[model samples]
Target: MALIDFSFYSSIYSYNHLFLTVLSFLVSALIFLASMRKSKLKRVNLPPGPAGWPIVGNLFQFARSGKPFFKYVEDLRPIYGPIFTLKMGTRTMVILSDAKLVHEALIERGSIFSTRPRENPTRNIFSCNKFTVNAAVYGPVWRSLRRNLVQNMLSSSRIKEFQHVRDKAMDTLINRLKAEAKANDGVVWVLKNARFAVFCILLAMCFGIDMDDETNEKMDQVMKLVLITLDPRIDDYLPILSPFFSKQRKRALEVRKEQIDFMVPFFEKRRKMLQNPESDKTAISFSYLDTLFDLKVEGRKSGPSNEELVSLCSEFINGGTDTTATGIEWGVAQLITNPHVQAKLYDEIKQTVGDRAVAEKDIDRMPYLRAVVKELLRKHPPTYFSLTHAVSEPTTLAGYDIPTDVNVEIYLQAIGEDPKLWRNPEKFNPERFISGGEDADITGVKGVKMMPFGVGRRICPGLGMGTVHIQLMLARMVQEFEWSAYPPNSKIDLTEKLEFTVVMKNSLKAMVKPRA
Candidate 1:
């Protein structure tokens, strides 16, 4: 009986061990099968891209080279061809290097291209709130708000009416610039001061006050925060750490609060003031706050929620501020680098203005002057690439089946520099915009070639206003001073680095010899 019991126990243990081993193998086999199926399913007919290692995609590409890593993609355009594909971690992006393809994707198929919203790190304070015009989804609300903004704030007639406000602001800028030149002996903090002054003017016009010290500092901090957050990274493409790391998220919320602290009170004050029948209409001409409040005051328009109101107000100041200053700086950088371009520009301004302030109307007449500005924009668009337009739905492009929820990033930088479109692509030639000639008509946002304010339905609504501001300001600044590169290099370096916007790797520093 003892011998039988021992054999029975040994047999039972052996069976159990064998059963366990079988179960484990089966589980492993199932996992492998499942993973392989997913790999095949996800591998739709997409364009080929550079081979990336498992887990990390082009982070190594960025580390090996440039700040705007898009430059690397620009480099690859010749080899892989223009419409190459990229896989940054899990994120798949299609780059449109050719101008015709860009227009096909963005302009011709506007509805398809318009769905991609601006992504994380750059979504700013207005991201969550959908009521604000820019953040709203592609729908009725967006159409309504965009129309209102154009008609009320950005129309040519409305812009013409606000000529004085723009003029007064420019005058303030010139006076302050002159003071800085005298005080610093021409080594002024031009970048910071130009940024601040432009911010102050735009903020005041929008909200009736220059942002407070606390608020201004907060805005400055947000600018720095955005630069770090907007870094082109594989992790950002995949969003694996999005939940764990909320550094960018926290910064966005904090920035919004600071903006609200300054904007809300001003919005409220304007609303109350406009309610009065005897309010000063003269001071209210084309002002931002007035338009928002006008709707409520007249009871003809439905006003946005107080939060929405403040968000809109904040974006107005934020969008307009950096853009105007950046445009000026970019033009200066271009002019300094291309002395021949500068001389022609100076001569055009000299003949048009004759020591008078360059008026808005003067800009319309000066075609060569217009060409210089156009070329500068083509060369260095402030925002080289805005957030890749998200493919909210499945779409077809170039016969490729673009999956839903993918991003289609049309590279404005590449498109502008495409050899097929612009000859001698590296050369800075303003005369390329001359009409009735070889590949001309680089005239306006509506033109086929270049788009600084972006393109298609998502084009910047404030483009017209922004264009006028840039032209008038550039005309005046060049007309007012004979600018020369300080420390006298043969020419300006014209190198670029992409921050939140593409800025000169070297700050646009120059000797401001007065044009007597």
Candidate 2:
């Protein structure tokens, strides 16, 4: 009787377990089917795009094309018209290559199209879970952070206050370039020195501390590692494949830790200075970190934490560094490629400043100099695409449904080179702005003719600062030295490669000779 009772209990236990398993399976199936039904019910008239395969969509084709993603997108533009959709793994990207369409989406309906897409896992680690201004969702947090940065550091008044910072950086850059040219037989790597100079300016503005070359270089390396690790991985789009990218994820975490370790001391230093202003005589009177310390975002009780501070400062530093440096390199390349344009610019600078250094006030008086800088930007905008934007809610753009889940990106290069917008857009002509060829509205406020610095609400907050840096650096470099192509007569190869920004494939090697 005991044996029979034990057997009966064992049978009951097995039956109960089996029933629970089946029930769970059925529930999961129902949920999936319901989700499918709901998705089907939402009638979305998505923009026309190439047919894609199951799960991976057009990712495989894109990967197999062996073309830079930007070039690949450009190739698709003629086939799919101005606006088209691309299914990149599980994520949807709607690319805008037309000026009108970009203006309509980013300007006419700026509010809906201002938010950033969900960052990949690695980016999230560095972005401090979207607490940084650029990565934050379009909301009170983004507004507060952006407002604080602009008012405290990037505003016209505030930028004026940092003139000494710019002057010092410029002097350092000129001295370094001269030394580099002398050391290397008059051949200096343009991008390397330009990046260092911009980084110095941004670093001082960020922490209010002037670090030594070794320390700054170390920090710069950390920033570069963070950028490298943050590059898009397959697992970012397809979470199911994450196990395959374990090494990448691990490296990303390591880079994040390194970034935090390097940046935290700067924050602590600033914090102490804020506490006792007289304690640190070396600290600048103010810094972007100072504003961050006092910032109170809408969902936080106190100011940003140490990690968040690092993220914000990182964004501030990295944001302007690469773009400004790249711009300078491109501008210099153009001057080397077109000697007439360079001569004209030199004439303008000489007439404006008269053998002295190009000051901030002198930039406005030099129209040709401004035009040359503008033309360089129009030809080679730092990045091919603007930061990815996402809609706040499901909306319609140009009669196509734009879902909140999709990443909306503007092809800045295409817009800048649009034939419909400019006369002879392919040619790099600075006279276009002055000779009435085209009224270049770079800000895109009047119209979307050319947007090197982007347009509308979510435009780069450091736009003014970046432009000033590029213009000033170019002016001083031109005024101090006459830049020509390296190896005497070789052409300045204009082929571009995408790095942190779109940089020269053969980083500009120029023979910079000091002007007599």
| TM-score of every candidate | 0.82, 0.91
Please state every model's RMSD to the true fold in angstroms: 14.2, 12.4
Give residue 104's error in model 2 in angstroms: 1.2
State the lDDT of candidate 1 residue by residue for 1-516, as single tens digits: 000000000011112333333433443354544445555555576666776534334444543443345666667777777566775545667766677766777778778677644455535345434555556667776776677777777778877876776787778777877887788667554466567656656655675543465776666665445434434332244455467447656766766665566557766666665666357443453367776653432222566666677667756766677766776787877777777888898898888778788888888889888787777777776665644565556777777767765667666667677677778777778887786253433322344576677667777777777777777777777787767777666577677654445667787777676677
Whole-structure CA lDDT of model 2 = 0.80
lDDT of 2 by residue, 1-516 (tens): 000000000011112334334433443454554445545565678898887644455665565555677777878988999999987656888988888888888889899999988767777888889998778999999999988987877889998998999999999999999999999999999999999999999889888986898999998998888776766655555565678678888888888888888789888888788889889787789888889887989877899888998889888887888888888889999899899999999999999889789999999899998888888888988777777789999999889999999988788878888888888888889998898667777777777877777778877788888888988999999999998999899998999877767779898889988999
lDDT of all the models against the reference?
0.62, 0.80
Best by TM-score: 2
Cα miss at 102, model 1 (Å)?
1.1
Off by over 4 Å in 1: 1-37, 40-42, 54-67, 117-125, 208-235, 246-248, 277-283, 293-303, 435-447
